[model samples]
Target: MSNPKIFVARLLGLDVFDPLGDRLGRLRDVVVVDRGLHQPPIATGLVIEVPGKKRVFVPMTRVTSMDSGQILTTGLINLRRFSRRGAEQTVAGDLFDRRMVLVDEEGRLEHEHESVLEDLAIERQRNGDWIVTEVYVREVTGRGAFGRARGQHRLVDWDRSRWARGTEPQGATSFVAAHEDLKPADLADMLHDMTDKRRVEVANELQDERLADVLQELPDDDQVQILSHLDIERAADVLEEMDPDDAADLLGELPDNQQELLLELMEPEDAEDVRRLLEYEEDTAGSVMTPVPVIMAPEATVAEAMATIRQTEISPARASLVIVARPPLETPTGRYLGVVHFQKLLRYPPPEPLGNLLDKDLEPVSDLAPVTHVTRELATYNLTCIPVVNEQQRVVGAVTVDDVLDHILPEDWRAMDPDQTPAPSTENPAPTAGGPASARGGAPAAPAAGPTTNRRT
Candidate 1:
């Protein structure tokens, strides 16, 4: 049967399965090799985000089926993480919405006009190799505010489109739009896989709040790299958007001078909070604890506490427990009354005073306590979070289970694959049915049909 042409956009997010019907991951991007100025790029592989949020490359040769909603491949799969190389680019990440000149069949630029590359269409040849054969583009009609442009859209053969050369600043509007729904952690994983240039471009394009959330999920090096690339003022703004403890942690990675400059640029209140956290030694309850936990006064009602935790900005760990203090409910709050677990709030009447239901017997940890002490206290009491009190008996902050785990885990835990079993090296000999390809490179073959339902091997 003749192979059908597929638009690359439709393939994104499709579930990928092995020959035995076991799901391996979802398709995230198409890897293509550049084939000179006027030739169609060859589709080499698919970037699949597998279990544990790790992305791996699957050579096109191993793909057996490409049905709606899912893709099927030969059982042989490499468990190694995907890393892009020179001469290769991702269709969605690198090309989509890129500016290119419209050319005629003779390869001459048409009327000095430019168009935005919106999408690419890839077709499988009779011999099974897949190539990007067509491009959908939108002519740049005019420019508007914020670099936005008005355009008329059309489709053209790939050979008639010439990618504009030179270091024109590429906007990440389309790229961010493609993955806008991704969680911060998943988006961080995708960013971790991108080339440094592309990663910085996308980071700069993201809103401060969104970027802050993603920064917290990234490894320390990545966080520093991205922040260092930004303008000092903007970097400070992003830091202000992050949780006080996270901002302090990231700032701690920089030189003292740079840290002071960024802090100086931040709003006074935000800077103060981060400065307080920075005063503590690393891995201590004071350093890792979030100073913005849901705190209310003793006179606050159960309903008020519930409403406070219900805010979208409050994290689950912070919301799990409400600290009831005296006047000045903020961190460094007035006399630490006690904490009321979320469960207790649910049990009591809406108007019940938080002071009457406080868990007084549950002691707060000292800010100077080591992480080991905090971890043990949390584990012993089966608590999601515990308040950290200063020498004055004021609620200074709260350390949650996540904070403890983050401190206790290996420093490189974010980059480590969750499945610790060693995977067969990609340099190994090919197997009879399906086999691993050379690291960073592979060839294509014809496609075949396979089963769809997921099952264990």
Candidate 2:
């Protein structure tokens, strides 16, 4: 199968494509309904930009096919005279809102496309027509877009061998379409939508890598629950799927019982990685970074680097922090050079020496250092990520702005205080029978109005 042609609307940073090769306006944003009643989410139309004339707002419903370079629409809408709305943010922005398929590293979906994960699985029923199944795990007390997807489904029948164990994959490049009912992208959306309870249920049922992707997008609470739901053997399989820092972060949030359970569930290598990350505090650079990094010896060839990247897992942080070090030191010192971006590395000649590509005049920080330093550096450079190094210059980890935002923002961001900060709950529960209301807390029970038995009509 050919790769699903995906169009990165370069002009607008929006992704739009039709399977049938039609041009549609970029997807600007989506409205999700996670906390309200009867009304479903209303998808916003997009403004298709034209060269000289006016732009038009094309309703997403007009989309007939979504594949590769363009989005096929039901009918052409002349958007030449279109007006702009405030919701036309980039697709990256929409992905971080926590309520849609498009999500950011912080586990929030910025866009809320109601149609995401709306798979058309063809379940054969002995007849010609196939069963169109929408695969999702339902939940009670769930929040976010998860309200629409809550239930226990093992997805036991999926072809695991197709997704893994392949030298050259045979199905769709996206492979998302291979499953009649599920797609990685759609499942990615469900990862953000599921409740802690339901997420755990789904986590236990998927492949480790698949589960890892979902868990990576979940909050601490949900991460713990999902990990808890899996047996140690199965949980370990998924644990290996995540980046070390993420695995550490989730394990750190689990109760003692669950933490131990997950650790035991993990393989020695994965367990060791988490152990290393857990060695530091949540606010520390060490805790937030993965000790496992892509380090290059100064003598290595650029071709070797390319081969390595293709072989190992690469994270957003890793893409930004490619450390070049002298072989003598496990951790490069003043000898340690600055980081080179993945693009730069890829662009360099394959035969170039690592030393030639190393940027020596770089700032380095200790893993034990505060995250604020990383944040400050990122702010100064306008970088999405920064690198952490030891005193000897050995690269220890990379810090991402997304993770920084996660660290700064509280879980219940809705309950902000007067200062626009998350405030502590001011409510106090009512006292039980015979318990003094005043003593039970809450504005001193209005001073109890002692001896107020006087009947002054």
Candidate closest to the true structure, highest lDDT: 1
In model 1, the clashing pairs are: 128-446
Query: Which tens-of-lDDT digit does each residue in 1-457 have in candidate 1?
Result: 2355777776778889988889999989998977766567899999998987767889999888785568889967786556554356788887776888877778788866688776778888887788888777778888879776567777888888877885233445557756778899999998988888888988876767788999999999899999999977679878988999989999999999999999998889999999999999876779999988888888899989999999998889889999888878777888888889999888999999998999988888888766776777788899999988887888889999988777766676667787863443333222233221111011001122321112111
202-238: candidate 2 lDDT, tens digit per residue: 4544545666776776656666666667656556666
Model 1 earns a TM-score of 0.58
What RMSD does model 1 have?
20.8
lDDT of 2: 0.49
Q: After the best TM-score superposition of candidate 1, give how far the Cα of residue 148 lies from its true spot, in angstroms.
A: 22
Alpha-carbon lDDT, every model: 0.79, 0.49
Off by over 4 Å in 1: 1-172, 421-457
Judge candidate 1 against the unseen true structure and give its global Cα lDDT, from 0 to 1.
0.79
Sliding window of 10 residues with minimal summed lDDT for model 1: 436-445
Candidates in order, TM-scores: namely: 0.58, 0.48
Worst 10 residues of 2 by lDDT: 442-451
